[model samples]
Target: MISPSTSQVIPRAADSASTIKFRDLDRFFLGLLVLWASRAWFYPGDVETQIGVEAPFLFYFTLACQLLGFYGLFRLGPPRIGSALMSQPLLLALIGWGAVSMAWSSAPYNTFGMVRATLLMMMGCVYFRERLSLSDIVQTFAVVTGLVMVGSLIAAVFFNFGRGTGFHVGSWRGLFSHKNGLGEVSAFATLFFASYILAARRAQLWAALFLSVSTVCLIFSGSANALVTVGSGLALMGLAFVTSKLTPSKITNGLIFIVLAAIAIATTFTLVTVVANSLGRDMTFTGRTRIWEIYLRFAAQQPWTGWGWTTASTNEVMTNLVRTTLKLPYLRSPHSAYVGLAVELGYTGAALYVAWLGKTTVSALLGVARRNDKISILRASIAVGMAVFGFFEVSAGVLPCLWLAFLICTEPKKQVGPGKNARA
Candidate 1:
């Protein structure tokens, strides 16, 4: 089993017990509130949006949390949480570009707001460093996921009950106003909780319940993409387990199993969702492929910087061509994150973006494979989930979810067998 780096020591405070707990509770509450009231959290028609307010209250609240976190960073001074997050060469450069990207973002103010939120979540992570167990983190996710499921269920019941829409299959939107948004949240939550469930040592039955409920929500979402991603991720993990069991020697076999599992899961979901439309799904994905082609064609117009941020908004010509040529509806932007980055940031930005992703992916996979510590399996699962979702959701690069991914990747690995990180 791997031990902590000679230089990587976790910081502790004289009276950190209650203080750290408070921070975790605050963070969890903020996240829950946002997820529960996401629609009204910062709506386009809300006061913040109507009065032409540049940044939303949620944005400022997050910024305040970051300020507090920075204070904690310096005040609670000691060995940093993990150098990989702040000192990674490629990732650091990418974050620098991301800061610049915010200036030219389609919604600059919104992007800035989200950045603050992301930082705040990271603060919560650093503050509660060794205070949390694998089970502790998992239960927190389960709680948040439970909230998400309840919200979705409420919205679904509302849409289907006493309405004249004739029981539409795809009209149920939970915290957000769109069914697709609900699908994204459910997919994220499912994978998030599922990783914890798999790594958990005790309470397997409760973990099973969480997975079952999350699965039902994902299916009822009727989001073909979400279903495909979640199903494929599980299948990939299952394969990894099977292969690990088959190996003659389990020592190096476990490491190989972790690496293959991460890659397989990542590749499966990315390919399935990215290609599902081309295989005829009769949905937004059906239009994504066409959108990608059109984005490339326009990007070729100016390969260097391409079109500046919001300046690259899809025009009617490309939208019409795709809809007519491919018989799909008009989608405003490339449905894929990579394509979106290419259209807005140009090749230079796209190259940097991809490099950043590659670096992070490598770091995550390495973090899983090299460490025989606790939560390695969970970290691997999270790395796979991030890669899978990156293909479809633009938020893969943003807060809440991104912060969750960071926790999974950077947390200390428990030196137990695979899928049993948390001892009973």
Candidate 2:
């Protein structure tokens, strides 16, 4: 790990955030390349059979670049790097879980791989934390979404299923193989761009355009979960704006946050059944519900140290749902990270994981509430957006969440005035 430079004084941290630099950008792009290549490379046929370059050589090349990039970043400031990594209790919890998994993981290699990816992504967030403003991140996401939408449009135009009747708009999957993944990505892009618009940056027209394209993409991808996540985020953003007038004392705000969170969780569970029925959506939840049910029962059986990671992908319970139930092919992941962890790691691990996230949520809410500064408030708002996203998506396991969270958590702790922070 590289140390922080001694020349600059770290600002008052609702929390301290690291700046992202050119090297950091390189590392991030390399990481993305490695991930995209892994889909084609890495883990070809069965161990006994030879698969053609199953593992992509590009992964190694990108990995090497990431290492160099990270090293350059670490050299900039040891103190900041170390402090950012160690100070957050939530982060500590994740590390602790990783340590435990290394010792007891059924699929040690897979667990190790996940740990490495998680840590690397987090480090990237720290590196970019200081350099990129929130607006910068938002704008970048908009640009990326625009490119994705363009690609999707081309695919739709070229890959026609019939004359005059092109592919189903709701089922159009762009670069990502899965429609839901596309929906989720577009939804996040929508939220990201909307965040900038709400922050009242000059890119209102661009942001609106991004949101329009992303909305079309979101509807095209047809992911119910994506809809929920994006809708909830927007709702929260609206609530924040509406409630801006009702400013309370810090202690009072914190208490209200706690109360509201508890209420939200409970209400979600109680109303989940009703909402499911009312939507009359697929009972399988596109196969996720079956997985959820299986995991729920399986967790009760062991409740502690799950069946462990399975490379074979044979375990019916691992996949949770059978073909008859969901009509989908055999899947390795349980769809939901939280469900997978609960079934594989048991309640103890799940609790620890939740505790970590809980801490992060609280810290973010506190940062937003306690800080009188405008920049701090924007940071807080982003934190809240992330928290809202977590409710619908089990992001603890996804690379994107790690990157987004790290970015939000590590932003510069500068002071600001209220007018600058207010939503447009």
Candidate 3:
């Protein structure tokens, strides 16, 4: 017979082991939850339809995941709510403004729902940033996106899913409803894997494999916007790398780099315009300019506070007005996050977004100047990528995977004090 002391110790040890196992299982489930909430699969209708009228099943599933994930995070431990809120002041302000817009929203119900979803998503991002290390977050993104790339290939090859649709006949949309969806995700995957490869001291070969797959998907999807986003990311990465090497320290050097970057961006924009004209393409960006023109005209009518957050796509009257004005079939979105923001929340929201971008950019510059580390460079690249992608996509306007990634990747480093561990 065992002694009482030994028997008690055995139960205690078993409990300890069980706790460890539970923690691991919790992490696995949370990762899956993140993937589910990302809306990685193809929506049945036009992309704008997703914003206004998501499929019932998808909507409920995502809602459940978000609720569960938030609960799980709280169970893990009381989050540093103050720290999380302080880290994303402008983002919180933007969401608050969106909430306030519900008062005048054409579709107050929809605005209320979207605002709640956005708030939950932002909270989830904060929890993710708080809980995971930078490397862990990057790896999680890379792995999830790698699965998407692999699944896309399988869907395209065997099931012929998301292919051969009318005007987009030859484009390989894979598991996405549209080619641009596939392209955008693939572009982001490429960036994630690239960051993984750069940061990891080992297992780079695996990261490279995923990187290649993502690149191939990006090419097959045939999205010019995705191509531009990837190019912008690469350019920013290159710039960050160069800045880190040339001036690893000094605020003056960072300022100088910023000036050079501004000049380069202007020159690049001018060259792109010229090149598009030379290639016999209209400067309309495939009729997007017309859409922008019409949207801006509407926005000017409510310069201070527009129709309300997410009204551009959800409000029937607004959608009808835009469609009738443009006389274009299947043109629901403004096709630009900036324009969408201007239309939905007016100039106030637009200014807040600009301020947020400026804050992120400054933080990135400071990070590179201070640390000159791979993570800092990755953050800088993402900041630039978002700024560029926002011009062509509703990247910042909604609670999408891209926005989540931006929140996590560009978050400023937390200060660790005595007896404190940064990673959960």
Task: For each of the candidates, give the backbone clash count.
Answer: 6, 19, 0
Candidate 2 worst ten-residue window by lDDT: 1-10
Task: Order the numbered candidates by TM-score, best leading.
Answer: 3, 2, 1
lDDT of 1 by residue, 229-335 (tens): 66655555445545545556655655676667668757855775667657765234544665677777767875756554433333356546655766544234466
**lDDT of model 1, residue 40:** 23
In candidate 3, clashing pairs total 0
Query: Candidate 3 residues 272-305, lDDT tens each?
Result: 7898789876564686887888889879989989
**TM-scores of the models, in the given order?**
0.68, 0.70, 0.87
Best by TM-score: 3
lDDT of each: 0.52, 0.51, 0.69
List of clashing residue pairs for candidate 1: 373-413, 373-414, 373-415, 374-413, 374-414, 374-415
Output the lDDT of residue 350, model 2.
65
Candidate 3 residue pairs that clash: none
Residues forming the 10-long window of minimal summed lDDT in candidate 3: 1-10
